[model samples]
Each structure stands twice: as structure tokens, then as C-alpha cells.
Target: MDQAVCCYRHPDRETGIRCTRCDKPICPECMVNASVGFHCRDCVNQRGGTHVQPRTIAGGSVTSDPFLITKILIGLNVLVFVLELALGDRIVDDFGLYAKCVDLQTLQPARCGVSDGEWYRVLTSAFIHERPSPVHIGFNMLSLWWIGAPLEQRLGRSRYIALYFVSALGASAAVLVIAPGALTIGASGAIFGLFGATAVYMRRMRYDMRPVIALLVLNIIFSFTWANVSWQGHLGGLLTGTVLAIGMLYAPRERRNLVQWGTCAAVLLVTLAVSAIAVSQVTS
Candidate 1:
């Protein structure tokens, strides 16, 4: 076997230094010693040509910015939990702190607080949780992180964020129809959407579905076991995620943008319509 070439900057030179860039064998002439290893001129030029490096995880798949958006969401959840904790006994009686939507009497949008005009609670309630317990927030945030990060990395920031919010709204829309008087909070709906997305993504990508399918089953089982969990929200999120993922990943490649958007819009409208009918009877 030929001996490994030395990586020093000399043509005839031989030593056991490795090239940091490209990992090609570099006899001394080509070696430019850097902190990690000797690099060749071509490697340096290539690195320079690509001004911005793509971020990658250890296995080399591209990853999104880990700290900025994902961590910001986590931080907000934690901060809200802390604030809820600090309020102590006052938190229990205050309706303003928690998110509520819909008037019990009119079945229309109403203030979450005692007033009758705060319709924003329909969206705002997503950010809040029912209990102030650290464990509740911890579990929800952890679930979001676990499911959200991989998705953001794969789908890019904006699309992934849209997936989250839309799926959540779908879940809330379902909950509004199914259980209006029940105060629902936490990121579970969004988390369920991720599961739905993951399943569709894996199927579209031709990845193994065993792991993802198992997770879906376990979560559904857990929802049944746990008293406070919203089965409606979870089910709604899962269906929404499946439908959205189909639109995003498997919609006809030949279709124009407007056509695709219109298809998704029509599906979403039907979903909301069904949810509204469900909520009307249940919340009443």
C-alpha cells in the first residue's frame, strides 16, 4: 500500500497531515496549513466562491437558524408561564389573562374578559395555557420544539410558521364548534399538526412511516387518557395538517400557483364549515 502523503506546502514533502477542505490527499506543495488541517488552493477558492455557508446539522442536512424563531417562540411560552405563576391567586379569577372566544349567549365573537368586544381572543388564546403549572408549559413547549424545528428546517422559516399558525387556527376552529364553553389552551393543536405534517412529509418523501404512525397513535391514546386534553382540537389539527401537507408536497406540479392556492382555500373552507356546525351544537 502506498504511504499517505504529507500535507505540508511542498511538492515532494510527505507527512501525515490531513486536508481540512475536500479531504483530498495533499503532498506538501498543495498544503496550506490551517487551524484544523492543511487545505489546498482549490478548496480555498471554492470556499471563497460560496460567500455564505449553508448551515448543517452533524449529518450534513441543511438546518434552519436554530436560535432565532424557534427559540423565540419557546422563550415567549416560558415567559408567559412565569408571569402566570407570579400572579399567584389572582390568575385563577382573571378571565383577561386567559384567552376566550365566542359569547356563550349569542354564539358570536365576544370579549374574553367581562366585556363583549374582544374578538381577538380567538387568535390570542392559542398563545396561552389553561393551568399555570410549569409542567404544563414545559411539556407543550418541548413538544413544539421537537416537532417544529425539524419541520422549519425542512420547509424553511416562513412556510413552516404558516403551517403552524394555520393548523392551529384549524384546531381552534374545530374546538370552537365542538366545545365552546370549555377553555382550551397550549400548543397541542399545533403539535398535532406537526404530526400530521410529518406523516404526509414522510409519505411524500418516501421515508419510513412506522415511527411517525406510532407517534400519532400514542398521542391519540394519551388524549383519551388525559382529562383536560381536547380530542377535537387534536383531531382537527391532524386532519388539517394532512390536507395542508398534501397541498404543499403533493399538489399537481403542473398546476399554476393560483390554481393550487384556490384548491387549498376551498378545502380549508369546507373544513371550517364542518367545524362551525359541530361547535354550534356542542358549545350550546
Candidate 2:
């Protein structure tokens, strides 16, 4: 009589199942289903590692679907909008980015702008919109959905998110430097960043750049022509996103990872330095 084969993982458990790749005996608990047959945990993990795609600049797994991050951003923006509507104009007053030099005490309604240490407006302002105008939130969210998906795919989740906040900060910094006393709200800066990044990537890949360039030109013109638009915010975001894209898409192959990350870090640091200077100028 032939002796029974025991599982490699659990010597006490005997089974007919064997790893598809290694042909080793395995118990049910150790088995991972494969296209042809079951593979053992070791074999399955090894195969997965072998088939793993290269990491992005930010060391995140590359995915074909960009919808996850894009949807999250959209959802957050919408959620904030709903809260703003529910809570009234108070939410906008507290969250909207304003010039540090603006004296909140002088405002008619009282506490309409940031107080002396409420610096979080730089980030919070991006999620809020002008309460009276649904069009502000509508257009920004529409642009976000339109441009964010492809950019997320190209940059990967981590890098895409990083680029977004960097662009936002750039916008806020511009507001602080150029028009610190004016109240600004909306994600237009980040949306413009997506547009800029997409254009840069497309240009680097030798794709036709006319469409993106035209869109950017039209938007800039609109910013100048439109009553409430912040041309400074748009310009700042576009410039920042373009610089980051150049680094991400055109780095040398031999040291691509290092160069990509280094470029992003450098841009972030410069933006921070600029913001710090602007804040100091405002406070002084």
C-alpha cells in the first residue's frame, strides 16, 4: 500500500491537494486558488511578488484604477459643501482663506476672518466655497472629476495627493502674498494644478499639447475677466504643478526614483519657504 502524503505546512494533516507551481503537498488552509489549480501560500506569495508592478515616485503600488482617490476627494468636497449649506455662512467665514493682515474685529458681522493663529485656513479654504454661489462649488468639483482621474493614474495615489496639496498651498501662498486681505475659497487652484500636470505629462510624452494649452489660456483669460476669480491662485497652482510634472515625467531612467522624489521635495520646500516669507511679511 502507498503511504499517505502529509501537508508541508501541517504535517499532521494529510491531503491530496498540492501546490500548482511547486507541486508540494499542502493542507486546505495553506492552499490558494489558482487559475489551473491550488497553490500553497509560499508559492502564491512568490508569484505575486514576481508579478508586482514597479513602484511610483512616492513608493506606492501602481494601479490601473484611479477612481478610488479621485472619488474620495470629490466626496470630501461635496460633504463639506453640504455642511456649509446646512450650517449657514458661519462655516465659510471660519474656513475661508483670508489675508493675515485683515483685521477680523473691523468686519460688520464679527469674526468673519481668521484670528491671529488660525493658520489652518490655508488647507481648509480649499474645501469650502462661496456660500451664495452654488456655481463655484459646481464648477470646481466638475473640473476635479474631469482632470483628477487621469492625473491620479499617471502619478499614482500618493504622488497625486501630494501634488494636489502642494498646488493648494501654492495657491494659498499666492493669496497671502498678492491679496492677503481678500477672502478666497474653492478648489480651483488644485483643479488648475491637475490641468497643468496633465498638460506637462502630455507634452513630455510628445502628445499634442494644443488642447491643454488652449484650455489653460482660456481659463487664465477667464480668471482676469471674471469678477470673483483669483488670478494669482490660478497662476501659482499652474506653475507649481507644471514644475512637479516635469520632474516626475522627465527624470533620467538610471536614477528616476531619486530624481522624481527629490524634485517633488524641492518644490515643496520652496513653496513652504515662500509661504513663510509671506506670512512674516503679513504679520510684520
Candidate 3:
């Protein structure tokens, strides 16, 4: 047999393992585990790419299947819509978000009794939409598909999900504060949150932001101009997503994961606090 090859980085050491991809000798220090076998540092990095590959929470290269999470989210929305259609007003009455501050004294007790103090409505409402209005669900899901894949890839799975729910809560809180007597439903708040996050993240990455900015402006205008649109929900989710993105994108590299989680928690707590105050005001 020919003389054993030594690691490229460590000439003094001989290794039996060769990189699975490049077939180069790699010492323990230079070896990176792959699905098939060990790989050299160079080969691993090459496969992962030098630029444009997003990093995960643990700082490893993000190589998960693209748009996996986005697909699941869309699937969930569609499933819920189908269930709502079959169940009719029963689903809407139980799941749709109603203003906690609705004057029950003036309304029929049976109608208003279940509306107040239903905290779960804040989250469940996001999954339900007004029946017979395919336009509402259609536009929201389309926007989600447009932005969710890229944002999920950049932020990784955990952070992306966290940003979504927090932003949804923020929207619910806004509805309580700004329009506590109005019935609200739909994922527009979470979708708006994704939009805001994408806009901020793209700006930080030095990517062209005009398209995002224009979309945001047009959406804001549409929220205000369109009858029955909840501008408060849109604004609340947008602000929350933007703030969370700022924390995630600008955090110190030394402690990035900690800062990102902490920022999300802080935003969630503040939103809950605001919601609590609003509920108290309504009940009082």
C-alpha cells in the first residue's frame, strides 16, 4: 500500500479517515462528522457555502429543508378554515376574539356571557376568519407564503415561531386597547408581523428594501382606508416584529441566542401586561 497520507492542517499526524466529499486525509481536529462519514473542514465548509447560508440558534449552519415550517403553518391555517366551515357559527362564537370590554349590561346575557374574559380567544382568533369571505384568508395566507419561507430560513425554526406568537399576542393586545368592543379574527396580525420582521432583517443584511417598504406603506394605507380592517392589530404586530428583529439582528455575537430569547420574552411580558391593564379597565 502507498504511504499513509497526513492531515493537510496537521502534517505531523497521519489519519486513516479521508473526507467523504473530497477524499482528503483529515485529522481529528480537522474532521467534521457527516451523514456518510468524516469530512475535512474545508469540504464541510464548502458544502455549507461561504455566504448566504443562514446560521441556527446554536451558531451552526442552517441546512434544514427550506420552507418546512412555512408549509406547516399554512397547512394549519387551511385545516382550521375547513373546520370553521363545517362547524359554522359555533366555531366562530367560541374561537373568535371579542372585545372583553363589550357592555354586557346593554346586550343579551346569552350573547355576551361567553365573550368576556375568554383569554384563549386571543390566540385562537388568529386561526379563524369570517366565513364566506375567502378573500380575507386568501390574501393573508398568500402574504404568509411570500414572506414566511425566507424569514424562517434566516431566523431558524425556534426563533421564527417565537416571533410569530409574540407578534400575534401583541396584535390581540392592541385590539383590546384600541377597539375593545369590536369582534376580530384572522392571521393578518401574524402576517403583518412577518412582514415587519422581513423588512427589518433585509435592511440589516444590506439587501434592497424598497419593495418591502412600499408593501408596508401600501398595507398600512389599506388597513386605514378599508372598512372593517383592524389597523390597530396590524400596527401592533408590525411594531412587535420590528422590535424583535432589531434585537435578534443587532445582538452581540458573543451572546446572541440569549439576547434573542430574552428580547422575545420581554416583548411578550410587556404585551401581556398591557393586555392585563386593558382587561382591568374594561372589567372595572
Q: Each candidate's TM vs. the true structure?
A: 0.65, 0.76, 0.78
TM-score (C-alpha, index-matched) for candidate 1: 0.65
User: What is the descending lDDT order?
Assistant: 3, 2, 1
Task: Flag regions of model 3 displaced more than 4 Å.
Answer: 1-61, 101-116
Candidate 2 TM-score, true structure as reference: 0.76
- Please give, for residues 182-209, the per-residue lDDT of candidate 1 as tens digits: 6766678877988898788767645557
lDDT of 3: 0.78
Instruction: Determine the backbone clash count of candidate 2.
Output: 1
| Residue 16 shift from truth in candidate 3, angstroms | 39
User: All models: lDDT?
Assistant: 0.62, 0.76, 0.78
Residue pairs clashing in model 3 are none
Clashing residue pairs in candidate 2, if any? 99-180
The best candidate in terms of TM-score: 3
Candidate RMSDs in order: 11.0, 13.2, 10.7
Which one is best on lDDT?
3
